[model samples]
Target: MKQDSTLVFIPSNLIYKQTGYLKGCKKCFENSEVYYVTSNKPIRNTYQYQCIGFVGETVDFKDSIGNIPLFINSKNGQLSVENNSSITQILYDYDRFKNSDLIHNQSEKYGQHFKYLSEKLKTTREISQNGRNSITKYILFLVQIFDYILKITRRIHQIVQKSSTFAHFEGNITTAKWFLTTLMEERKITPKVGNTICAKIIDLVIGVILTTYLFEYEQQIFDFINFNTEVIISNLRGLLLYLMGQPIGLKLNYSYNNFLGRFFLYHISLWRIFLQGLYPLFTGYFKFLVLPGFLGFSYQIAMISDVVSIATFHSYCIYIYAARLFNLQLKCLKSLWRVLIGRKFNPLRDRVDSCQYSQDQLFIGTLSFTILFFLLPTTMMYYVVFTVFRLITLTVYKCLHIVRNTMQTIPIYLLFLWIVNASSMAGNIHIAWKSFDDRGNVKIEAKLEKLPLLESVKKFIPESESPAKNPRGFGEIFHSILTGTIL
Candidate 1:
């Protein structure tokens, strides 16, 4: 008898790793060939005796609709040669295939609530004993250290202000702005609050200060006590331009408030997030490959890069907000389009709430990794080396903050401390929870429900059979109900 039919396997372990599947396959396909196709290589099933890894894409799978093929691949294995004429080819590309595995695993294991894959599973005992060994704790720890140093910086400002014509700005927020003037004056850069030329000079001074914090500074070497204690902030374009070593412009986002304009706006933010994520990886690669540096500056540069990582974290937070904003804007535009076209559309009026999103929680979750990465890829570090690396990281972080809030009257340190405390308190009380779910999909508990907020975040942390129907995003509960859909 000649081999007659095929059973196509996805680039997933669930298909191959199940016990007795190969034996079942062997018995069923005794004559027919079983094709194991994938783009990326799969890890061998160590449990099985005849396990083999599948690497690279094989024959591309084409879908035949209307005409049912001899075989149709289902999530559960139920296809055979007798029931079907041919096996349906499920072509697996490298990126799409791996992502499929991630989604499948998360859904299979976690079901409804999707969490970060890299996040270690914590037991109740572990949670009680060590707390969540999450990046949030590391961020909180590093942030506390910076908070203390901010107090010192405020004292320095107080003393410095006494001697200069600059009066003490009262609010905690003004400490940073006031400090910028002090820094400019100290550098002989000439602070002119009333003069346009002076304003440009101040920006020049700030720019130099920003570059010094970002690149290298003399004080960074000597100021061991004031480690990672510089303040800094940069607009998206400026940071990209400096890091990439070329002047680049933003993708033209035209907002005409018309049909075309709204459509473009709806799509723009989603693409923007991908671009932002790529930039950090780009900077990381560029530093390691293109920008060669001495081993001496290795740790120092690594420390500075901590701020870069944190900035990336901040950008991710912004991306989340952008996503939320786009969701609302898109829904309205879609509604308008339906109305204009005289389509049956239900206006959801009950669940309307102010568009409020949290930027801090996302930062909190990523902060741990930002600090952790500054220490390098070492899993085990000597105690002394770890302490020193931490100190270096703190120094760099502090420096960025100091530069960013240079002209502020209020101490940025205290403000940061407040945010941390607020985030922690609110989160524990169910006000501002941060589950740090895979990508941007966040399912909150109390605070969100009390306020009756909608989860506008979509296509993030996708689950296979999500109870929250539309993984692309089930809009506000009210909207779902109005549409007679329970997403």
Candidate 2:
């Protein structure tokens, strides 16, 4: 009872139609090759009249020819793996889950941005109105100095990424790898940690040199600062004067408008005096004052930015006052309108509910609504103007910080490691064709290989967070305009 040596091909649908039976017949054999599973005992010369192979789920195959579980093509030299539908379905479901996670992460990022904006708004208002005491001033100075150092360190990385020398070094990395591989293996030194340590050292040296250069030209920086400050004060004076009149072709409350405009102008006069008093101090040892023992030039530039922010504190104060008034009036008008409609908002239920109002309540609501409606245009105009000014300031700083972060966080060191020793950061291996059979048939062998440099780089560099969030998006701004909410 030796097993048959012949292996044959047959359509899976034909075998399935037999209901798990091994029957040899003209109908089953027509246009199909006879197939049988066999043990390697001997080849058969006579055709077996009955089917000779296991049938049904045990010998599973696709219903179609193109999707056969295993096949060899003379035209192509590829070996395709079994394509199970269940596995494909599982992959599809996983992709769908990842898509949902992407959306959830986006919303979470938006919330974080909104929170950041709100905090900045509150801090700006506080600084503008209450003014910074000596302790607060020192604290602000220390924080800004630390931020400057961080930015400079990031800038060093930027310099490295842009260097022609580094690019050339990357080109000869293959040679370097061959020379250093033996030593590196003996020392158990991996490229990942080596790249990081080298990058840090480079950044430190370059940052120190750059800061020293900037310090040497301190006088020129002070001159530029003085010129910019003068120009800003002059432009601000003109802007205040323009706002005091009917500047934008719209009729505003003349008395209130002029009062706010003149008050800020006087405040600006006081600021000019305050700045002049501190001018000599900045030109002298302001660096030491800002960062007790450190004398970095980036700190000076940051201190200059802080000074500009202080110079515009009066405008922020005006924005706060106008925005608050506009928001308060809008809220009052909304409540009164609800009362007129015989509805009130239930905070607990988070929805509007029917309500009954007395005659006095109705009268007061109506009167208040009418007054707020009339006064809205004046408050809105002030709020819009100040908001524009506030946005301009925010945009400038936003751009500056974006540059700093880009310099700081880009995976240049990992990328450099990828260039020099890609295997050090490799995460996985893939199979690739290694050789062909001597018979010149469609048969081949594959060898396992590490991921390529680009793919390995992805494994080493962690995924970055979403882009920088804005204080308000265009849709939110548009909605606020329609609803009369504070922007």
lDDT: which candidate is best? 2
Instruction: Put down candidate 2 lDDT per residue, 1-487, tens digits, no spaces.
Output: 1221111322212223222233221112222222221111122222432333322233334542223342222233122223311110000111112111011122341233222322322232212224335545654565565456545545674553333222222322322333244233323344443443444345345546756655777788789878887888889889878878887697877887788788778877887888889899877874554441132222333334455567677777777777778888888988989999999999999999999999999999899998888878877777888888877876765564444333323467767755653434433222223334443322212111234656554454422212333457879876765554554
- What C-alpha root-mean-square deviation, in Å, does candidate 2 show against the real structure? 20.3
Instruction: In angstroms, give how far residue 290 of model 2 lies from its true place.
Output: 7.3
Tens-digit per-residue lDDT, 1-487, candidate 1? 4456443433333342232222111223454444433222233342532232222222112432222222322333333333333443332222322222122222342222222211111110012334434544554565565567556656776553332111111122242343344333332221122222322244345544544454454334335412322222224334323322311442222221133223433444454565456655654554343222221122233334443544344343433443444444445445434333334343486443333234563354345435333322111111122233333444454454343233321223323323443221111112233343333323222220111111111111111110111223325634633332211
Worst 10-residue lDDT window for candidate 1 reads: 448-457
What's model 1's overall lDDT? 0.32
TM-score of each: 0.16, 0.52
Backbone clashes in each candidate structure, one number apiece?
45, 0
Candidate 1: deviation at residue 395, Å?
A: 36
* Model 2 pairs in collision: none
Name the best candidate (by TM-score): 2
